[model samples]
Target: MFSGLPQDYSSITVTNDGWWPDTDVADFQSQRSIPASIKTETVASALLMAIGEANAELAAYQSAQRAKGFSSAKDVTGPSAGGVNQLCAQYLKIIFARAKAELMGEITSAEREKANPGQQSEDTRDRLLAEASFAIRNIMGHPRVTVDLI
Candidate 1:
């Protein structure tokens, strides 16, 4: 319910649709195939958890910006101004979708989840997770490893 927080979704989505809509997940659906046991309500709960986690991760940057006396994010308008905003949207969509999939017992490769036994291969889940973290770093920027005493 926070103001200036992307309205929990953008103009492209119906105002009430959870994080990333089912329609928006065609790639995941085709690749993984949704498990029959995962109910709509369960997905909703997972989405809430995912949104909370994403918000927590972004809080530090939001706090820093507020301390600078920027009235709010809405006042800014430009491609560069939208960097954090764009990243924030992408972060929520991806993190939530992944969480929901995991909750549905679909943690394996999308191909594996598709029941493709022949394609079952070495576990690359860790690598994918690392890549996701790298993307997040692009959004958040690398931490300062040293401080100058100037």
Candidate 2:
């Protein structure tokens, strides 16, 4: 319940569909503690952007998986939760973190507008992005960092 206001059923819906796992707006909001003031459209936009970015980042890995007879992320063998693929879970983490980071500024503004007055620090957003990057690397079976002699 947000500010005791009536819920926007429409906003609870995910605005886009794609080849990757579908993003549940309601789930994202709940898991990330998104306020109603941020509007579903804003969140959906951020999600779409994050999906695009993640897809772009994973293109090569996806291709390799396809070459190995896995047509989609879901087809790749991995640990499963409630039958959900681990890769799918990690992909959700990537998008959720990216989307939340993208909304940090709007979240702060919305909080201030609602008289909540809590600041969303840059460090928080950076951490969210780092989480996304970590998830990406995890799915890719790559280390979180690389070192090279210069």
Candidate 3:
């Protein structure tokens, strides 16, 4: 199905912190529809960076869960979505969204100009960034928006 692609197409797993499950680079590419032009190393680097940022962002939440007697994300009890733990899915969402956003930013101005050859109004990077933020908040059991009356 994927002919003429230079990618390895093998399942290369990216190891995350012990609290979080490992991520598959191939899955990320498939889910994001990342173009073959993007190198595997670039995608792997982005995923690693995203994993680090995600771990840091959710450090407090993880700590809270641990304090509550939960050892890892899988230990949390909740309804599963798509047969996967909710929190685990949300965590993956955060990592995948952030990695995709970073990869979108990797597209140079010239590459964009050549690809579009016209004005493109949509900013996918921004949307992905927002998605990452939303997933982070969801996993933390925080409201997407917290407003205080001024």
Candidate number with greatest TM-score: 2
For lDDT, the strongest prediction is: 2
Off by over 4 Å in 1: 1-37, 69-85, 104-114, 117-124, 143-150
Superposed Cα deviation of residue 24, candidate 1 (Å): 9.6
- Clashing pairs counted in every model: 0, 0, 0
State each model's CA lDDT, in order. Answer: 0.43, 0.81, 0.80
After TM-score superposition, what is the CA distance of residue 92 in candidate 2 from its true location, in Å? 0.6
Give lDDT: candidate 2, residue 69. Answer: 82
Predicted candidate 1 versus true structure: per-residue lDDT over 1-150, tens digit per residue = 124532121112112223222222323333334433344444445545654555566667556656776444432332433345554444544554445434533323433445754334333444434544555565567642436798
Per-residue lDDT of model 3, residues 1-150, tens digit only: 446756555478998777787999888988776655677788899999999999998999999998999988887889886667989988888999888878765544424745652222247777888999999988888899998999
Which wins on TM-score, candidate 2 or candidate 3? 2
* Global local distance difference test of model 2: 0.81
Better of 1 and 3 by lDDT: 3
Each prediction's RMSD to truth: 10.7, 2.8, 3.5
Q: Which residue pairs show collisions in model 2?
A: none
